[model samples]
Target: MNTHKKQGFWHRFFFSLDHKDIGFQYMLTIFVMVAIGGFFAYVFRMHLAFPDMKVPLFGLVTNKDYNMLITNHGLIMMMWLALGMLLAVAGNFLIPIMIGTDDMAFPKLNKISYWFFLISVILMIASFFMPKGGLGGGWTLYPPLSTGDFGYNTPYKGFADRFFTANTFVLLAIVFEFTSLLMGGINFFVTTLNKRAKGMSLFKMPVVVWMINIASVLFMFSVGPLVAGTFMLLLDINVGTGFYDAYRGGDPLLWEHLFWFFGHPEVYVILLPPLGILAEIISNNSRKPLFGYKFIIKMTLLAGILSMMVWAHHQFVAGINPKAATVFSILTIIISLPFAGIILAYIATLWYGKIRFTLPMKWALGAITLFTLLGGFTGLHLGASVFDIYAHDTSFVVAHFHYTLFPTVIFGTYAAMYFWFNKFTGRHLNKTLGNIHFWLTFIFFNGFAFPLFLLGLAGQHRRIADYRQFEFLMQDPLPLYRHIATISAVILILTQFIFIFNFFWSLKKGKRVESNNPWDSNTLEWQTSSPPPHGNFETYPVVHHGPYEYNMPGKDKDFTPQNEA
Candidate 1:
């Protein structure tokens, strides 16, 4: 029962089997990948901003280089940074403590997952150094365009000197990352189901735990087809198989169907955790119990189920039968209902309560507002098959998704970081710096994204290296909009340094928290020490109330801990 050990660096870090250690490792890895992905974004934004000007570190980004940057940026942020941080980092770190367990059901598997993920990151970074540059087929990796002849071939001399093409490296990196996540998903499912403390019934768990479980199930089920499809793509590229090659009777649309089948649900997989995080933050800061807890759970379930059926909506303009498109459009819109309920439930949680405008709360509230507006945009425009026909592959679609994802993944993660930093690092972040980071981020994020909507409305297509090439985009106002957005993006990227400094600086020099429950919250995580020890609880906690028990009329304290006897 004594889980603590005298450990060396590698034992504690690289090979640690403890869930907390693995979770920390996952977070660190996510930070590194996010920087790399952000660099790619900066490079591409520069290309878009000044088409003729050579970039500093990376000189003139060719069309191929631009494509690779876009592809990798999307893939890394979505797969490695967002998914890894939310599920691998948050899920591993929080689930065991919240569920009153010492560790994940399979600790060794958790370590292995992180290692596989690290390997994936290595391969992805190595791809950039390849003579031909990295993959250029975009993150979707659609066929024909993604095939070996079209995607892997490089004009550079000695491209064949490498054992694997850059495109192959990209696919391999994905395969490794997917494999890592699949293992993590299994761990989440098994641990959450079997490891709860006594009196912790299914309904007694926090909404975040439930959301993680649901997202895990969705990921496990949806990713199989894409895994299979990726392997087929590798074969078509390297081994000369024609699974997606049209001239050999294979169909390119088959890849789209398979990819989006996983891709659409994948968005929800990244989304649900943030929603769950927001739920925790919003309720705790508002001094209220989560409104419509059961309702939110049921709606989240429905949303996950409906997510599978709506994949075809992404293919509306890809020449599917008109009736099929109609069916998909309707299903896509219908999926919005559960999300609407969840959003409303959050709003209800904040209704007329003693709302604390803490840094975390501000982020949670911002995420809700941003997600609602973006979600509304999707419902109003993109959900309609007819409107999607015109909006397909435009900057509008890009802006819409960034709105959903940036708020959910990035803002939600920030909220969790602020809310939980004391628990994780045993120190409070510099509040003034935190507020500065949040406000600047909020202003610049909107400044950067809102103009993409305008450009898309002006018929500006996505993935083009030079917008000036198109006569429509070259028109006075459209070009000017891009310039404004580019400036906003640069400022937005620069503002992140404030957050980075605050995070690391606080780890050593910030104010030390005097109590474990610094937020005065009710979750089981607060029952243990700040940065809880190796066997999380000295005595395993026994749950009494549900996670969100706040403002109980009879209780003297405003919040009620689940483990209170």
Candidate 2:
């Protein structure tokens, strides 16, 4: 592995053990996946928006093709892009630096994890080219549909074998992705536990590190059942196992059980890290200490615990015992309290502080605001078992989760990117373009997502290729809503090119940062040079204060560095 200071591109990028290099690799990989996933969204949204109109590149999208696109879109965006960007990119880049370590505890494992992730991505993309499109059963891969007779009753007739092969590839790709994440999680735990700089105890670490650690632990434990479930699914598909086939004493709902168990916790696994990112940005940009630091940590932990208990909430209408549904509904509502507290804490941090409207700050604020609205939506509709039954398979669920995920994943990532672009690449991104990107994203994101709420409320079923098929959805005003969402989606997709161009063009030609601590924020990462070389610091840093100490009394400056002795 080449050192960070090495000149060769492949040596520095392709096969480097340095955590920063690997972090960049993850970011780049996610960028590509984002484009692919967005393309999938564009195609499918086109079908939804204008079902009869001929689509470019593939003509009209059949129901099977729509399923393939939607499944892969969800899979790619959530698992591959969001997880890779937040966990792999932010975790790898920030953890070592913020914790005052030179590198990850297992740098080799880190490198290997990324390579495996790349391989998984390759397999996932290749699966699309399979004889019968891609795995179209959906991202959840529900039992009977996922397992037996892939093309038996679907519109795409006479392609059972092809769909079967595609399903195998999807499962295999997910397996590899999970494997990579497991390796990375191990590295995160070990690094956080054993590798902090002197005086930097666990409590003194930044909230982001704390959140990532919690998320990692949550993922490690929760993902096991799903991994096993996938293998059983594979066997059922290929070797005639009856693990999920109800006809042969296997219950299809059993697959749902296992999937949602991992599935629900997996939401928090992706969520906690980005929530932490928002915490860091909110506190720093507000020029204040993070309010209720210890309390927030406790609340986050409670949320993690409750997240595991709420899996059955998703199964409320899936033939779950009514008593079980009630229990799960109660648990799901309980889980929201901690997050509510966290949100309140963020708001408290912003009260009566000198707020900076920097690029990252704008994105962070947008994320939190949107999240608050969506959080309300979740509480209103998803927390109640009765409401959930109505909204379960509707676009309401789609809008709700997209509200939750897009803000956290997409907006949170943009916050991190704008915040850290200078540190990562030694050049500041074009602020004008970034601001335009942020505004357009915020506008179009809401435009695209809010109508799904209306459609879902009107009982528009999710994952269907054409809304026109349903007479209720075909009624007046609903079609207009669909067209609105589709148009907004197109604008949303096109607006990203501004960010993409800015990212690359600025990488080479953006204004060079004058100082390492351009933000004048109180975090350890800023203590190092712009794009710190080789080992992160010339010497190990000793922590002298908590991660955020903005606007301390008797300080000459508003912010105080964590490393100041």
Q: CA lDDT of each candidate?
A: 0.88, 0.87
- Candidate 2 scores a C-alpha RMSD against the true structure in Å of 2.6
Over 285-322, each residue of candidate 2 has an lDDT whose tens digit, in order, gives 99999999999999999999888888988788888799
TM-score for predicted model 1 compared with the true structure: 0.97
Q: Name model 1 segments beyond 4 Å from true.
A: 1-6, 150-163
Root-mean-square deviation (CA) per prediction: 2.2, 2.6
The local lDDT score (0 to 100) that residue 555 gets in candidate 1 is: 93
Candidate 1, position 455, lDDT: 89
For residues 1-565, what per-residue lDDT tens digits would candidate 1 score against the true structure? 5566677877888887888889988888888999999888988987887897798778989888898899889989988988898888889988898899999999888888999999999998988887766777888888777664443333333334433677778888899999999899899989999999999999999999999999999999999999999999877776666787677788899999999999999989999999999999999999999999999999999999999999998898889999999999889888888998999999999998889999999999999898888745565579889999998878999889889999999999999999999997789999999999999899989988899998888998887887676787787898788888888888898899899999889988989999999888888889888878887888888999988888989999999999999
Please count the clashing residue pairs in each candidate, in the order shown.
0, 0
Q: How accurate is candidate 2 locally (lDDT)?
A: 0.87
